[model samples]
Target chain A: MSVLLVLLIVFGIGIVGFFIGRQRASARETGEVKVHSRAYYHGWWVFLVSVLPAVLFIVLWSAGSSIYLERSAQASLPAQTAESAVASRGLALSMVRGIATGLDRLDAQELQNLPQSYADLRSLLGSKGVALASEGQDYMVPIAERWHSQAATARTIGAGLAIALAVAGVIFGLSGIHPRARARNNVERIVLWGLLAASTIAILTTVGIIFSMLFQTINFFSVVSPWNFFFGTVWDPRFADAGSGGSQGQFGLIPLLAGTLYIAFVAMLFAVPVGLFAAIYMAEYATPKVRATVKPLLEILAGIPTIVYGFFALVTVGPFLRDLSAAISGGGGFIMAQSVLTAGLVMGIMLIPFVSSLSDDIITAVPRAMRDGSLGLGATRSETIKRVILPAALPGIVGALLLTASRAIGETMIVVLAAGVAARLTVNPFEAMTTITVKIVNQLTGDLEFNSPQTLVAFALGITLFFLTLAMNIFALYIVRKYREQYE
Target chain B: MNLMTERSLEKAVGDKMNAVASTNKMKGDKVSVFYGAKQALFDVDLDIPEKMVTALIGPSGCGKSTFLRSLNRMNDTIEGCRVTGQITLDGEDIYDPKIDVVELRARVGMVFQKPNPFPKSIYENVAYGPRIHGLAKSRHELDEIVESSLRRASLFEEVKDRLHDAGTGLSGGQQQRLCIARAIAVSPEVILMDEPCSALDPIATAKVEELIDELRQNYTIVIVTHSMQQAARVSQKTAMFHLGNLVEVGETEMMFTTPKEKRTQDYITGRFG
Candidate 1:
């Protein structure tokens, strides 16, 4: 009567139906009458027909039955308990379900000699390894008994219906197999639908994430004004206790936005020239043997997890810069150990592979004819690349740089570790600063009430960061598309 | 027997207007070319006459293009390609270590089979060579060089109004002429063309052919052509190749009429390629 057992039975029916359908289709292949599809196509078609509906029914039934049992158990609660706050009601229902499972373990004699009080019942369930919460009440005993019986009955009826559907599917599927059944087409259609469903699931999940963040952001805005949150330069979100009349404090976006853009700009400054030179060398100058070995090594730099890069920045590069500055300045270093410079340098290293890989592909895509034309005109290789190849590939390279910029902006771990969390709006690269992603992590980590502005602010930060990256990606795609049309 | 007599009669008529022999501008001595492990061109000797259009005619993959590319050392760009014999420009070994390839290419320019104008403005495309070589001292001089180069390529009058338009925006034949202008801007003594009219329509082909005839007065031109008729029409001297070997070399009229080799006869008369 369990879901697993029902699934196994459905699979068995499908296997049987497969053989029967294939045999029938093969028998129809006489001299005058031909089977339209291969025998295995008919077999697979029948197997899908017999299995799909039954599996769907089992999944739907289990979900529906659990909801029905919870509702019935809640209704059976005592009037005082039933009329409690929604949170307490939910707590009571969970206790009921747990007691129901514990009751199933009791023998027949123990069931007949049931406890009459909550304390005694708790002791009996405790002996059965089902530790009920201290909030358990006497009325839960009867409800648990009724809940257990209803679940059992629901499972029995679900198993019967699923088996009956599988049998009917087998009969109907085998009946369709004849001299001219287009089983191959039907099977292919089913596969197409399966692929579409997979893609739809991914799209739906993205939409769901957006909507969930949007609603919570709306909740956060109700507590804090949009104008103050957006335009205020300060970003001191004072964490207030629930139900206390304390200042909500500033939730300014400017410092974090500046930090994000400034760090990304610094990373681009370091990465663009180096990465572009590497790309050009690989595309135009490197021999085939060198290129074959070097490109993958560059990509392997991209494969290193961002968290490892964060550790490197925190432990190695930040201190090295601080010491180097101290040595040169002959005093306490102007650069902070955990500063925007540290994070930007490390993040630039992380972004180098991204820029180089995309740019290498873009630069190589410049037609060989372009190089020949320039070289034939007596231009040196560097001169040819400077005037002809680079100009043709400029749009694509810009698109790649924009994509890398978005990645640098959204980077979290490195900023959190290397760039200190104090959200300062300083222009100096030596000072510690924070970005939106780092702030989002900061706001959400500690123990707090979900509805508090402190917690809700995380959702607001998340949506803002999402939109910023989204805009950059859209612009990048636009440039890439415009570049593509130039060649074709 | 009748075809032989007819060829003999045509040869007698061609002998009346025999071409005057000219000094050799570029000479290939026992030239051989290889791509990786594959030998593309066998040892061959051919001379390109100064200020004359010498056409190389052959079937596809018969090393005609290979020999043409070798004339400008363009094969050096291809990976694993090797040229074993000496190619000299006015008795100077082009492949010598002392010679700068950039300088040699400046003096001996090339045009590809397909029109490959730089993705730049037409004026920029023409000025690119002159600017790189420092042929002009000032902007005015650069402008004058561009105008004269385009004029020599026969593209000046047509593209005079839109000198700043993208060179790639021009039609195929115009693009090829722009490439020719780009080559001529450097004022190379020798120009190599690799099937320059293969990508053009008949009208464009005629225009390029006419331009080639005019260009022969100042520049030594070596052209590789698949069309026997194109070779006969544009070239003063013609060399026939088959299977990576030179079959015959003589006046274009005599080579087309009374070919010395049977393979040359078969290729030109459409017996088999």
Candidate 2:
């Protein structure tokens, strides 16, 4: 039986169990003693009990049967095929499974009158839409018949077991639906476990990603010395010919690191004051009508995709800056079309909402009494905000800015489109530079050998970027927590 | 409106009896206040005598705090709050267009119900007002003003050694006193206190009451209190309010002993709020 059919049968059983449990509990409610839980709770409790274990069994059975079929086919392999490489052995097993599936589609008369020769069997299976890659051997026909029978038996046993479990679960669940049964508690515990499992999956996925990248990064370090990869200034990872011994170019991290930091620094320098002023205006000075309209309009800037911003940079802002520079200098422009300034400017615009929205919330959280105290002391509104409100919200604002800085460092789409992929160690903001994320994308794209240091170096760069942002986030969290205790 | 006119007529008679006793320092003439569309204070007239603690006592939501906030124009900070009629300080209409609110507030400082100290060193909290107003010319002079203001607030002895510590680090009573000192640093002609001791324990409340009585000798003070005993203990004159109108105004002893208005009598006797 198909997995979906089994699942549907189990769900139908659960629905029946729900009604039975609810009816039993309601019947008990007619007595003098009151039911501990509501009828709905009793129904849900029965549904969970009937459905959860059966669905779990069906899933495991389906997974286990596939592994068993593959192993049996591997054991039935001919001596010459078994002695072949692992890749060929895998290919042969897939062909065996395919022939088994094709045979199941044939009628009883066709199965009884099977082809005897290898070529004839191939032709018959091919006619049935199962195209085998290699020439078939003489032992394949018998093995395909055997594999088909085993798969059928496995499916039959699995369907029988799942149905039995579901029926037993319904009986056991209805038996517990008495007046004093703690149905609600049981259902609530199941919900708690479900939520915990969801969060655990998310956390486990993050850990799994880190470990996968860590192993590849270790492999890359084995090829390139850590000292050279970290401290080297040049980032000339020349693409060597595949499978040919040639020069593996330098993979210095300094220029990329400098570009990342420099661009982020410039973006912060542009964003902080503007975003902070906007936040102050929204939180302190604007009337409710004006604030209600302005806040969402600013958030709309955040809703825009970064790739669209990249397109804007590539098509409009970069050229505009270059032309403006050319007009002033009266020569080939000193500023390149794709330069650090272009990327930083666009990235700064993207980060404004990040800083403003967070800082606006933090500033508004300062008690209204604080404003009154300052105004009561004869300070002007500006004076009150300067000495009282801003100082109170400083730590939270710092944390917000740190988060914005991390976002700027990790930004790739705008930099890839606006900033040229030139790894240069320069301080000039008008010149082109590249960051770590841009280099990671460059190294991994296109056809390349997986074992090459060029591709493996992407993993190293990814882990480095991860740790850099991780440290900043941790520091920001520490600052936010330490100062949050002051007001409350 | 009829009830307001009748109460004001009674208040007029009381004012005439005390006219010769003391000159008016700050006078509210038929003042009314509105928040959005809701009228919070009706046409009310009262006078704050100079260098005396004139307490405004009323039940919750009776507009006593509203009246006190209007004296210093603190209500202007609240959006949609409106005040009409006249409030004059030393014979000048404070609501006149020519008056600068910042300067007017400099002459009339206020303390709120809750202690709200700036998140700064205790020294900065007091010096903030003087520094902004340029009341002191040099660092030494600013120090002297800070020290003398803290002294007048009666918190100098407790906080003199840790003047550089955060004002928010103080206890509830100390924080309230620190706020009082910050207000005093501006050297305003009048001081408004809105339930200043409500957040304190009994012992702290008693200390603050004693400080208020001492402060009356230097500045004109108007205090709003829920506790009738606090009004009687710390104020020279007491004004009773009910439902946004002034029920009676008289000497503290007479108002407590034999109130002319039944509302004031019932309230002071704890018959009902």
Candidate 3:
């Protein structure tokens, strides 16, 4: 039977169960004593009992049987063909299944017109407007035929077993519909498990990602020494991509790590003071009319996409800085359009609304009583802000800054467009450099051998970047929580 | 408590206060206030006596707190609030352009209903006021000022050992007293308290009442309280207000015992607010 028809029948049985259980529960209240549970609860109880077991059986049966059928199809082939087909079993099985479906589409007259031999089956099917990749390789015929028969048998059994289980569940549910039956309690427990499953999926995916990175990082470390990767200064990885038996290149992390920190530091130097002052003016000094007009205008900077910011940096800010540097240095400047200074300044623009808006919210959250106490003591407004307000909001402000720092470190688009991929170790902000993220992107873009150190190194860099951000987020959350406890 | 009926009784008390106007520390002449378009106070004429605790008692939203806040220009912080009147401190018109409000606030301090201690060491919390006003010559003088202020607020003994601890760590009553100490550290002449004991227990309230009695020896105090018994205990003079009108003003004993206005009688005897 078709899947849609089966679904309709299963739901029809659930409706029958619902009515049976509700009527049985109502019948127990013999015109004087009342039923303990509501009629809706009894109906839902019967519906769930009738549908869940049958659905679970169908899902598990389909998943388990498919794998078993694939293996048997492969095993039915001769030894040489099976050996050659092992690496491409999934692809091979999909094509064979497609051919079987095409044959199932034939009518009685069409089947009689086709030749009986396996050799002519391709042209015969082709005449019926079906195509195969390689006209069904020599050993695929027996496997395809067997798969066709096995699939039909599995479908028949799955339908029969699902309907029977649903019927049994319905009978059991109607028998248990007494006044004292705990349908609500059972439903609540199921809901709790459903919520638990939803939250656990996120945590489980994070763990799975970490383990996958850990395995690949271990592989990379086996080939590249930890000492060379951590401490060495030079960064020429072109030799590693020259195929096997070539001299391995230096895998030092210091230069990329330095570029990342330097750009982030410069970005912070620009963002922190500017954002903080803007927050103070908005929170403490601006009139309500002015604040209402200005705050959302400032937040519009946050709503802009970072890719657009990258485009602006690449086309606009970088050239402006380059021309300004030449003018300042009198034509002897070393500044390029794609220097760290260019990237850092533009990245700082992207980060302004982040720092200002978060700090503004944190500052405004400080109690009004603190301000009143200070002002009442004859302190000037500036004095009150500097002494009382900032100190009160310091811990939360620190947490906000650290979170911005993580975002800066993880930032890719601005660095990719504005900062050149030179990977040089230098202190001058006017010089070009590359970050860990930019390097990761550079190594992973093209198709190549997967097992080579060149491709695998992205995973190693990825895990390093991941741990750095994870540590920051944890510390930021800790400080924020501690600050909340003090005031609350 | 009809306005027409209370006006006759208000005149009897007005004739009595007219004889004692010379001893007043602060005077409000025909003070009318508007917050946005709503009139919160009518023409309120009052005399705050020197070196004594005067309590302003009224039901909520009767403009008692509003009247108290206007004395120190604290209401100036609220936007869209306008006051049209002459309020003089020591015979100088405080609203005059030549008079600096910052200096005026230094001479008049306020305490809020809730205890708000700066998230700092107890020593810093008290020293904050004196440091801002440049009242202390050295760190040692500042320490002495902090000690004396805390002693005056009666919190020095409990917090002497933990001077470096955050002021927020204190109990509710102690924190209120700490705020008092912070205010007193500036050595202001007039102290305004808006229901300062409302958030405290009975014992703490009594302790604060005793401290208020002691403070009256040095500074002129104006207290706004909801508890009528509190107004009777802590104040030498009592002012009764009903629906934005000052019904009567007299000695606390006389005001509570033989109030001139029937409205004041109704409010004090729990007939209706």
Candidate 2 residue B41 Cα shift, in angstroms, is 1.2
Clashing residue pairs in candidate 2 (N, C-alpha, C atoms within 3 angstroms): none
Q: Write the per-residue lDDT of candidate 2 for residues A313-430, one digit (tens) a residue.
A: 8889999999999999998887888889999898889999999999999999999999998898888999999988999999999999999999999998989898889999998888
Query: How well does each candidate superpose onto the true structure, as a TM-score?
Result: 0.93, 0.93, 0.88
Q: Candidate 1 on A330-396: residue-level lDDT in tens?
A: 9999999999899999999999999999999999999999999888878899999998899999989
Q: Estimate, for each residue in B32-137, the C-alpha lDDT of model 2 and write its tens digit.
A: 9999999989988999898878999988999999999999899998999999999999999999999999998989999989988888899999999999899999
Chain A TM-score, structure 2:
0.92
The Cα RMSD of model 1 versus the native structure comes to 3.2
Q: Model 3 chain A: which ten-residue window has the lowest total lDDT?
A: A78-87
Model 2 alpha-carbon miss at residue A5, Å: 2.6
Per-residue lDDT for A230 in model 1? 90
Error of 1 at A163 (Å): 3.8
In candidate 2, which residue ranges exceed 4 Å CA deviation? A82-87, A94-149, B1-20
Ranking by lDDT: 1, 2, 3
lDDT of each: 0.89, 0.89, 0.84
Worst 10 residues of 1 chain A by lDDT: A479-488
DockQ of each: 0.63, 0.63, 0.58
